[model samples]
Target: MAFFGFKDIDKLSEVDMAIYRYIVDHDEQVPLMRVRDMAKGAHVSNSSVMRFIHKIGYNSFPEFKVSFKNENQDLMRSQQNILNIFTRDAFPHDIEKTIKLVAHLMLDADNIVFFGMGGSGAIAEYGARQAASLGFNSFAVKDPFYPLIAQLQNTSNNVIITLSVSGKTSEIVETLNNFVNSPDTILISVTGNIESPVARIGRYALTYNVPETRIHKYYDLTSQVPCVYIVDGLLMELHNQDIERQK
Candidate 1:
């Protein structure tokens, strides 16, 4: 089976999910298929296939194929590993409490600031955009200086979310440290390492642990997936809360 099956299908766009479904239904042929071949079978463009692979956390088609083969060789073991990875780390009961708390904070906050660097920075920007779409006043600060300034200017009604895969990025840690004693502003950290500096200092930390692999040494993948998933879950919960209040 393709490794993409391990991801949350609801997180995919309609077109991407359609392509993913096609691949899942044709699992027997997927290992032998090329990007172009998969696109043809799914009636999607080659670029669509490429995007789908990246969205599902693979850096490239070849990387995806190799992992798919290894995972499929021992499907039961692979599925269990995936289940443990997500359930134990990503969707644990504490994550629900964190999302609920974030939803409440966002609903009442005057502003929301998202901070990160590198791949985590990109995910931070995406999360900020998602929050804005959900009607929150949000800003994404990828630069270290901007977050420092934001922290200096924002009041207690502000909410800050920092994204760091390792939770030990120096700039992010320093930024969180600046807010360590702030009484009014709330800090939330989304990270892969709960014990890292940023997570330890934040008011609330959402942790998602993906097993380190040989592929990770060469390609920074899967780290963003859990972050994005947490952001989406928070947004969805906030939306639901809003609808309930309206009712």
Candidate 2:
């Protein structure tokens, strides 16, 4: 895939390849170019430009241009050494599956608990609030004792959503291990590291590809945008599903 997750040019026909190459080479200008103008520049017909745009997964030229501009804007904003830009884009890749799974879990659970520590704790709180707004029984719990109490009170029909950017937080890992044997409890972990211990313990894992920086470990420069994106997306899906059911 090219930048912004566009299909590889090599997969296109000869004519479409030329048009795609023109777009890539003149990305800054293509977003503003009319179909006829782009066709003329690429030595193709206007219909061919439309076909290429649709072939690239957009409904129309305007849609394609909007996505192109948004991707470029993200790049421009991240030029100042922000790693979160890349992480932000990662959310959309597996969004459909993640949202579906999370929404189902939320609907099925009697109670939903959000767990995290430090920076992740804030994200957990925000996620819980978002879920609550969608009418789910959700709350963020930072104190380990609270989770233990909740687990003891209601072991079955409960869903736990945990956030750990590193996916290796000892406290999270231990907490997960405490409930690993509970077949009725569903654990969902959101993390940048899919293979880390915390992710492994979860029943479902939502992962974002963020480069781990040592600076992030000490100073907390890592972007929580991906975590927030996943939480928001999941809540939106749940809301949409509820609307559909009502209709």
Candidate 3:
């Protein structure tokens, strides 16, 4: 197979070659698996896998895998390639799966509550706003303690959507520890790390593997843009679901 999308397969470094070979070997698999697994198979690190994907013209490992499998070949091939323009395009990553997951959760939910701190908190608010516009009952609680306590009461069977990219924010971590066991509430975590504590606590977790938009790396709030995009996409699906339900 073509390594790194070019004829110069031998030009790649050992790390890149390992990742490339792994992708080619597993390109036929269905449902697309994680880069972590592939890296493990190659006995390489996750960062090395990501670098390999980037070297191969993909923005992220997820994008690379999506193209590699060609399982949804028509949809994958037909769509326009999305390129990130640094500050202009903000969320250059495609978070469609995360949105779809949230939509499905909302479809069966009685209520929805959002939790986050700092920029993730803003994302929580954005999600609440979008859900509200769709006539869904929702709240974005920036103050952590009340929401945690509310979950314990079990008065409403709401879905608690926690926005924590790293999945280790103090507020989110504490909230999960306090509320994860609630019988009436379902925990939905939108985070970058699928293996983090928040994801572990969540009833459903939508994991984003974008290392490029490291929100915590800088002082700016741009990292939260991905969360906003995800919330918006979820709202679109929720609107569709509502229309279907009404019809």
Candidate 4:
């Protein structure tokens, strides 16, 4: 059978219960505390501590401490994320101008293309569906290797919306740069970095100004909450403008 689960209170003996209680109550201290200290604090012997360590499936104290520290970091990061994200002031100072510009572009565009990757890719899909629901010819291209959707014609009446937390994705920057200088084909990028390549190339860039976050070297765990807010704001602006025209 597998070792006693953290929640297996019934399976935990009295000594195990003592160890579990001390660890939970002193979580922040346990990672840094010595094994003998843990035993002393838990009111158990050192051998009891070893038994509890194996009961929880860790072969050694250092191994258990590493796992505990990672969990602690995750907990702290999650708490910080919740406490710090999404306030009215977190939006761009010139959001009014950006929204109006996006609205104007959508009204004149033949089609809307949204571009992004990973977490931002999901946001691109959402933006396309939302814009389409508002009566725009909208589609999302998440694949970095997608074939040319259409020729890069000046005044082609096309608009592309890009979502990138860093605004540094090479495929998006290279593809959009070819069309940014042309008239009637607008590029609107939503990013956290104003100076990033994609943002620099955009006709209009809306930024959230949040710090980038990554849980690992290759994976970006940055908050996309601001991107969602900006896209919704833009689509709503277009929707309201369309309503005004009808009346």
lDDT (tens digit, per residue) of candidate 2 on 1-247: 1245764756889998898778878989977899999999999999999988877788877778888898888877878664426744675476678778788888778888889988889988988898888888888987655646555465578888889899887777888787787877788988888889988887888888766666745766677777888888778887888787779
Clashes found in each candidate (C-alpha, N, C closer than 3 A): 0, 0, 0, 0
TM-score of each: 0.62, 0.62, 0.56, 0.66
Clashing pairs in 4: none
lDDT of 4 by residue, 25-79 (tens): 8888987899899999989899999988888878898899888878777777768
**What's the C-alpha lDDT at position 136 in model 4?**
84
Superposed model 2: Cα runs more than 4 Å off: 1-84, 87-93, 147-152
Q: Report every candidate's CA lDDT.
A: 0.80, 0.80, 0.71, 0.83
Residue-level error in angstroms, candidate 1, position 68? 18
Candidate 3 — worst ten consecutive residues by lDDT sum?
Answer: 83-92
Candidate 2: TM-score?
Answer: 0.62
Best by lDDT: 4
Best by TM-score: 4
Superposed on all Cα atoms, the candidates' RMSDs to the truth, in angstroms, are: 11.8, 14.1, 18.1, 8.4
Write candidate 1's Cα lDDT for 1-247 as tens digits. 3574564777888879878778778877888999999999989999999998898888999898888777766775656655344554344567888889888888888888888888878988888898898888898989886746555564668888989888877877777777777777789888888888888887888888775444748565654677888888888998888788789
Query: What local lDDT score does residue 201 receive in model 3, on the 0 to 100 scale?
Result: 90
lDDT (tens digit, per residue) of candidate 3 on 221-240: 33455566666667788888
**lDDT ranking, best first:** 4, 2, 1, 3
Model 3 off-target regions past 4 Å? Answer: 1-101, 151-154, 212-222
Better of 2 and 4 by lDDT: 4
